[model samples]
Target chain A: MTDLTLTPVQTRQSHIGKAVLRWSLYILLGVFALFYLMPLFVMVTTSLKSLEEIRTGDLVALPREVTFEAWRTAWSSACTGIQCEGVRPFFWNSVLIAIPAVTLSTLLGAMNGYVIAQWRFRGANLIFSLMLFGCFIPFQVVLLPMARLLGMMGIAGTIPGLIFVHVIYGLGFTTLFFRNYYVSIPAELTKAAKVDGAGFFRIFWSIFLPLSLPIIVVTVIWQFTQIWNDFLFGVSFSQAGTQPVTVALNNIVNSTTGVKEYNVDMAAAIIAALPTLLVYVVAGKYFIRGLTAGSVKG
Target chain B: MTKWLEEHTPKLVLAPSFVAIMIFVYGFIAWTAWVSFTRSRLLPKYEIEGLIQYERLMASPRWETALNNLFVFGALFIIIAMVLGLLLAILLDQNIRTEGAIRTIYLYPMALSMIVTGTAWKWILNPGLGLEAMIRGWGFESFTFDWLVNPDMAIYTVVIAAIWQSSGFVMALFLAGLRSVDQEIIRAAQVDGIPTWRVYTAIIIPSMAPIFLSAFIVLSHLAIKSFDLVIALTGGGPGYATDLPATYMYAMAFSRGDIGQAASSAMIMMMVVFAIVVPYLYSELRSKDD
Candidate 1:
């Protein structure tokens, strides 16, 4: 058949056709890349522009002259409903909330995951299943009750209250991450460590903990993103001083202040988004690994 | 004493998390379920009434809009995101050299908070100096992309922003799925003179069924839980025209002090989730047994 061997001109023509097709694919992908990147580009450029320029110039144009005035105002002096303090205080609030919550959940999850994966204890599978189910419930179902519970614990409207809520809600995902990661590890390691007369904590400490660095990084990054970007809990469970950056950013953008400063709003948004974006850029593979592991397992 | 400690220590380590889940997650769900049946108003009422709040919720016009919008939004979001994601994945799988950088760009939006996504889109769709203005500046004076301000068209804007945020995620899932298919099978098909399109449509796509389900579950779950994006983009505004159930529940409980309505709406949301998730979980666990 003609397909058995191509003539020279035919080969040349087919190569040309293939090159055209490949270029078209790249062009299509590049177009979509622009679609996805456009908003971020606009956000950055608009944040750097003067208000006058934003009003007069094209939405996607490069700024005529970059200015940091809006960034300064958004960070330190913009009004977010009765409080002239910008999102700076609330930005720190998110940091404070994310750090402890990530640490506590990851540690607890490691221990829980280790026990469930290693021991095969009684009722272990059922408890793990129930915890896994807990991950999928709409947070609205738990919002009212969590608010009341936090109030009863005397930590309502406080950073600790928000932290407690996150760590509790975050338990299901963190544990799932650790448990799945631990399951791949052979059981003989634990059995050998037990033969060394090491107790539960000792075996976990010397063997599993050393090997848990990957999962720990994954869990910490996952928890930090969830807690940092949280808006519902931050809005519902927090008061003025304790609200996280997300709630504050919402207030600032939606706040009916003197003038509608689009530049300031964009800057505040970029600020609120910076830390998680940094994590995503630096450790994206782990981020994707966490996402697939966490979502698909459920 | 030492023997008892040795035997019970693992359970001891897990006890706190176990108890916390039991109390905070399950126990709180029970509490919310109980409140949904009551006449709770400004504050929660302990005495349970019979279906009154659910009755009110069903009868309310806004709740009707919310349910209708959820149906519309959920269907479109899942379908479009899957199709677009699949296309992007196929294109990216062409053995292109810029795959890593392009993948990063596509997924970077996912790293952003929905609030940020909303903020960015809100400005872009501002009707005056946003997309409309830009197009007008480009000599298309009659052009209008004012979906943000038009009550009937506002929910679609939310869908657009949501797709922008999530489709890349679906692409990542599909790319991984596409890569996992056995290359030898594809090669054999190619050698059999099957067209590239035929090989994909008949062999590759169908084999990625599990990933399709996973993507569906994730997208639908996200659609149901979507609150921040709606709040930030439109504030469920133009007369509550874009109210999802989550935003409706928030308005009722926190804004309007109608806890009963909030509780009922929350219950309905859980039911919707349970309908989707229970079967998925059942299959997941059953397969695990094999």
Candidate 2:
């Protein structure tokens, strides 16, 4: 403030410079935002167009006659095969699978994180390290064996099979999220709870759990997106009847010999992406915060 | 009794996740390793088949193509994402208005599944109905943008889509790092007549090295496991031009009914991942020791 008041010429020069910079920043950011949004913009426009317009390939043009038929078709009437049931049935299955998968995995992950970050039990660190290490292992390395094992358990191709897979993989990051968060939490809180004769579960349930809202939101959003959008596991672990929306979307999009239904494909993708996109828009700040804090402390 | 219960409480807390992960993840991975050496086809069979699967895998042109494609894809995806992410983060740090909306726009793609990403990008890049057609419609008949259909340039098209999808995540990481940097450093650099770009290039970027490495590792893992996008976009098409290792393994196992060969390909991928990850893990683990 003092420096600006003392230098009139410098202040005027600075004002002009600042004005130039502001508009330049706006223009630059506006351009990049379009780049960021191009695919989505194209998809939505195409989805509103008729099949003839899509095949004619004037993708950037405003539709001659915009229609919601593709959305209607993709949601309720498009064929996965001979069924023509669209993707509606699989939406509930996705919801059902996602709910429990998200719940159980997150609860267990929080508990594991609490125990790992707080308790110094023998071999606990080793187990936690191994679990974290598992985060790096790719799914391709486990698909065959998991198939065989799930077959042995008689759980292959079941919803339970998919839930079980989500929980297992979800542990890597969710537990890491909770664990790192718990580390950042002052140990005095836990120590005080223990001094009050609280057991492990009691302390976690009361003291730690209440303070864990941010991480819980993070895990829920992450797991929801992951399990909902998952394809390989959904396709591999489940039979045709039990597959999720991702598989149905794939089948709709990838029926090689049939004419590609660009409109319906775009609509279905928008449908598939809507849930997570909504979650992000509503809670994106905490999402970034959770990731930042979790990464730094972890 | 109290001592025994106290001793076992953490185990109880951890038991459910521990057992679930071991059985599903580690145990299944072990099974994958075992199957690679067997004569299984379309399913797992436990019989000693020596190294025949490995021999078959090595002989397959498709496997080689997938492996090379992963390298090309991985390198480009990481490099491009990092560069773009850092630049975006720096620009956004200029105290720009509408920062929230800008951030949301960048990160929205990360919210979508790769299936959606592939679908959306495929439409955008499709030679018949996408940018090429749109451009041609503008009266430039010679404007050729058919890389999605070209076997040679198909992989780069994948690279572009992937960079768009992932740079936001790297941006978030870099954004966090940039916010943490001391304002004093910027002031000092300005006092010394150092340009803002040079100061960022020389000082700020080096300071964000750890954040960069972590983002790099995460993206690299994603690149290795990239199947959904390939499935959605090209389907490894125009004659398997963009077939990545994970997709190749899926094809071998499910489409070709060669579980043994698939297992071999998966093991090779795991080995590649391990080679990259082990040293990284070692360093991360060692850092805490210091």
Candidate 3:
């Protein structure tokens, strides 16, 4: 309609107008990109600068003299508390905690989701509804009871205790991801497997699990991010030696007695952030799938 | 035994997770709810006394502040994140050349933990050495970005970092929703000489009601459970001025030795979540039934 109504000169003017609009859109998008990148920029720049330079120089300026001292300290020697061991132990602590928790939760959730979606027992829907509602409750509600229970179970303030808590809370989400995915898979495949006398684990292992590669990736990424980035459980359930990197990072930055080592704090923050950042950058498609597919923790 | 096992295998596999959830999710909620009614302080007292803890919670000024902050923070965080996220999504949808890089930048913050976000913003909002000092360095002597230290404006700073952290994900959500809108409808509307803005308002946005609701649920959920950010950024201070309920409960339970207060606050928080989540779940389940 615009082409039909416009003369030759009018079309050329409209072309220029559209060009301006398009460029302005790009500029607006670029500005937002800058806003989003600002903190990461500040962290990187501040981390690379010396303390003397950080104090005397601009907050967001590129470091005139770049140094890895802050990174070294943050990784190996920054004082998180009375302990000056840095976030290294806590970083390894997170790795240990996240792996078993992620694996166990993904496997358990896959089984639970498989049954609910395909096997459809007499009361499976009821069971699922019970479990599904569990996902949205704020962890604060569960913290006190879980603390006492962990103490009773004699795993309180330990790494295994943290893993146990994550696996338990993570079930609802893991089950959900698998259930929805398996539900999309045609029921006939499972029926044929069952008809051929393939048992429960057999059918799952040979048939469903083979088709489950994509969902497994999604579930693994989702649980890894949630468990890795977890602060509430990490802070509450673990003792000094068992603390995760996020808690350690918090302590390093917020410990009030020292001269505030802004560079070290930024480095520590980045170190804590690097794992999930890598996941988002490398396999962002699956990460986004997990995010949208009811990994409801924010 | 093997034949019997085959019949029960699905239930057998589910039994462990089911029992754990029952114990942790439902059972612990019951335990916490019981504690809220007890006189437990500094430890667990299993005896149910009444609603004394709730009365105490309602009467306390700090709890009042926490509740008020939740209202303010929840509202602003949801509204602004949604608006800004939708704006970003719409802009990114316009056949932009570098959309992936921009989307990745926007969504990367969600990958980082709240503690990281808070740590960065904590420095950026620092009064003496942060954005303020940098701006002052540019020859303006009167710039003050002291919300990190100011009592009244502290909660808003958390809101800022939170919006930065979450709105990108919301953009991703809305962008997905925008892309899923029927292209044919949009094409037809454009052929009718309707403006792009009109097409969005009249057709595209209106079709995103479900995504809008889901985003609201997600953000409000984030707001209610916000603890790490507050702790890292403000530590619920300048005298607990920025205390959200989650932080308030933590203070009462672990730091202040008021387990009863923690329990009661926890119960209230659960109630708030249930209030929001149950209906959302109900509607979602109902729709899935179709």
Candidate 4:
């Protein structure tokens, strides 16, 4: 009976059927890919079209007269609030906020992770646990108090204030990322460094830091994308002149006073999105690795 | 002194972040909880009252809509993303030639911010300018896809945009989980005259429970904190038809001068997060103990 099941006459027919099924699967995947890429295609084509062409054209049509005018306007001339200087200043604001936030948070997290993973002092687990909870809590829970704190610090509505918030909130994930990576390193490495009379800072600098390239890449990309893409903190903490690119993008697109410049809106959206998109396209493998690692550990 | 320093260096390194989190995370949570019970408005007041803000929050029809929308959006977003993501993962697991390209395409959305996703989707969903117009131009004059403007359907538009952004992420997670499943067991099952589908259903998928749980936790957390997406896409508009608690809290505190309302809403959001995360943490820590 088992032999009959294995050598059934249906095998020949099923082979062809499986081929058809496989092709259908490919087709289905192609359709889904189209769905995923459609908005991007629309954005690109729409951004390329002039206002007149956009009005006359369908969303899916390739631009009849491609122009960089929208791009120019989005970058240099578009009004985001009262400022007609376009998304430039806001773009720089985001850069300012993200660079420092990413650097400080990653450094702090590395130190925390090293201590928790290697040094293992008293109450270390408790500290790690408490920090990890920060990763999961809704930011609303802290927004009011954080606003009050930022105001009290007299840094409210400043880029530095936004950076502080990002760093504080970011500590949890960065710590988790580094701690997980460091946990896999053998304790003997640290012990050897200690035997050679290396202090904590020395061992970390010489032994651990060099070995952390992979995790650091993961950590940097994660932090860069996160802080770059952050909107809530950007909107809440910073106002007009200091607002990040995200807040500017929101303002530019959602502003209701003027003619609805869909083309400029699309272009500005692309500009706001370009950095992280570039990161993903360039280092997608690292991004995926970081994502999976973060999810799995959680 | 050297020995003491050696013993204490780790603690010293950890102390700053420890203190910051204590004040920033736990401390703020406590303060927000305290603020929720007061009658503060416009600015935070320290006068302690009892449940007036909560009572007002529960009374507001907008809050009711926001809570209901949260449940509806959360449930649909989680379920739809999981199903779609799993299906994509299973398809890609067939070892197709285009796996790398397709996976990259799917995962790219996750890299963009909610603002970008919301903006792009807004353009595509705009009634006269987007899908509706395109379909209408394609000789389907009666066809309409105006969920963007319809108040009753606006929240679903948020759901659609969110699933578009996140399903790819969930797919990557599931694909990773699917790849790590032992193949020998599947081959054994196949050799025993079991069908391929049966092997996957009965053996492979059962082992992926932990991934599903993780995905659920991640998606739920995202749903609760869904502020930026709503802001960019709908602005919780058409008369507050799509106010998720995050947006509600923002509107209350920043725009409406209702600090107490914001605090209460924020506390409710935290409670929702705790409801989901606390049990998951308990299980995780207990499992580690085992």
| TM-scores, each model vs. reference | 0.99, 0.94, 0.98, 0.98
Instruction: Write the residue-wise lDDT of candidate 3 on A180-212 in tens digits.
Output: 989988999889988898888898889899999
Candidate 2 TM-score to native: 0.94
* Clashes within 3 Å, all models in order: 0, 0, 0, 0
The full ranking of all candidates by DockQ, starting with the best, is: 4, 1, 3, 2
Across A100-208, the per-residue lDDT of candidate 4 in tens digits comes to: 9999999999999999999986688888889988888899989989998899999999989999999999999999999988989999999998999899999999999
Name the candidate, 1 or 4, with the larger DockQ value: 4
Q: Kindly indicate the candidate among 1 and 3 with the higher lDDT.
A: 1
Give the best candidate by DockQ: 4
Q: What DockQ score does model 1 reach against the true complex? A: 0.86
Model 1 local distance difference test score: 0.93
Give the per-residue lDDT of model 4 (tens digit) for B1-290: 98998879989899999999999999999999999999899878888999999999999999999999999999999999999999999999997998999999988999999999999999999997788888898899999888888999999999999999999999999998998899898888987889878877999889999999999998998999999999999989878999999999999989998999999999999999999998997788668659
Better of 1 and 2 by DockQ: 1
Candidate 1 residue lDDT tens string, A1-298: 8777989999899899999999999999999999999999999999999999999999999999999999999999999899988999999999999999999998899999999999888899888999999999999999999888888899999999998999999999998998998998999989998898989999889889999998899899889989999999999999989999999999999997588999999999999999999999999998888888877863
What is the C-alpha RMSD, rounded to one decimal, of candidate 4?
1.5
Report the C-alpha lDDT of model 1 over B1-290, residue by residue, as the tens digit. 99999999999988899999999888988999999999999999989899999999989999999999899999999999999999999999989899999999998888889999999999999998898999999999999899999999999999999999999999999999999999999999988889899888999999999999999999999999999999999999889999999999999989899988999999999999999998999889778869
Residues B184-286, candidate 2, lDDT per residue (tens digit)? 9889999877988898999898999889888877788889989999988899987999999999999988788899988888888888878877788778767
Clashing pairs in 4: none
The runs of at least 3 residues in candidate 3 whose Cα sits more than 4 Å from the true structure, single-residue gaps closed, are A1-3, A295-298
Interface RMSD of each: 0.6, 1.7, 1.1, 0.8
Error of 3 at B37 (Å): 1.0
Better of 1 and 4 by TM-score: 1
lDDT of each: 0.93, 0.85, 0.93, 0.92
2 versus 3: better DockQ goes to: 3
